[model samples]
Target: MKLSSLQAIPRCFHTTRWSLVRQATADDSAEALDAMETLCEAYWYPLYAFIRRSGYSPEDAEDLTQGFFARMLDRDILTTADPGRGKLRTFLLTCLRRFLAHETERRMAQKRGAGLIVSMDTTWAENRYLHEPVDHLTPDRLYQRRWALTVLEHTLRLLKDEYEDKGKGVLFEHLRPYLGLGVEPEQSYEAMAAKLGQSLTNTKTQVFRLRQRWRELLFEQVSMTLDDPSSEEIKAELSELMQCL
Candidate 1:
């Protein structure tokens, strides 16, 4: 789920960076909510994959997945998730492990998510589930891949939205080719520029801006989930995640 595409959903709807929120106006609060919802919608699939990888049945996985976010709000988890001690991927894995360890219910499939269900659209989620590669991975490997993918997806959304907000939609899409680079053969920047109808200079600028937004946004996304204020070592950790992607 590209948060860049979630223009349809207002950020005022979800409980996002509320821990850091100090906005006084109603409009600002609404935008924050929308971002929170976008974050939730963007991440559910990767979280679901991790739940399934943890040896839960499909129904169990789905419920546990639902419950995790429920706790994110109902337990004030998001508001106090800590801004420092670890990576968002690490934080999510730890949280998931703890949730799975303590959650002792069987599949009560009908008792699903409560009112916190995100209203964001999701042809992407459906397609992702239908086509996700599930073979050759033990539960552990799957969990790792889920972590990687989740961070990557979140970073993509952040970049996309930054571009859109700056009125560079075409330029944003042009930069996406770099994302799935390994999925396709590598190409020269000249080719990329020509394909996007951009000059070499504009292409370089796009890549530079993309990298900047990605790093800053990546830091924000990952560190905000830590157990401590990771103000000190957060950049190193983010650089590592970026290297993986």
Candidate 2:
């Protein structure tokens, strides 16, 4: 998704760097495991995509992805994550590169589906990979693009849940497209007002509010991936991610 429309969103602040990493690496408690699992679920596919771009077959990529996570969890590799180094996106990709270099032979020798640590929807992952545009993106570039999309997807999910909780689930579905640029003329505010049974003015107002909330949520989501980023740093990161799209 192009993020030009979201450029106006204000910066958001949050204390703590690599809170999720810290939580995931803190101990072997259930909470820590849950944190680690959440990270895995959010990012597994991007790593998978990277592996595929690096020339692994889908089956091999699936096995390697699973093995990488298994090794990460089993050996408590996250304990080595340093917030001062950079974002989690960079950290994971670096670790994955190292794993592939040293552990590929050992991991590939194991039976398929052995030592599964984190559950993933490999079927869905492969389908998504199949649909990707055949572009000139290198493995690293594709990883960054996928990572940006992942963040946007998570932000949209949060927005959807918020609207659903307020009994405006259907309205959210209609307004969602307006949160981004390039909505067709046929899907104009007047049409939305008619469908929503509200004044056109009110429909426009709702769209504005939706876009604002989306910006706020997107900012918060991006902020979480950094290590106590300044406002300028967050904006720069967002800009780079937007370029990836």
Question: For residues 74-154, could you state the per-residue lDDT of candidate 2 as single tens digits?
Answer: 677777888686587888999899999986456466788876777878898999999999897999999999998898888
Q: After TM-score superposition, what is the CA distance of residue 224 in candidate 1 from its true location, in Å?
A: 2.9
Candidate 1, after superposition: displacement of residue 233 in Å? 2.3
Q: What is the TM-score of each candidate against the true structure?
A: 0.62, 0.87
> How well does candidate 2 match the true structure in TM-score terms?
0.87
Q: Give the range of the ten consecutive residues with the poorest summed lDDT in model 1.
A: 5-14
Backbone clash numbers for all candidates listed: 14, 0
Which sections of candidate 2 miss by over 4 Å? Answer: 1-17, 28-30, 104-109, 181-186
Which residue pairs in model 2 clash with each other?
A: none
Model 2 lDDT-worst window of ten: 9-18
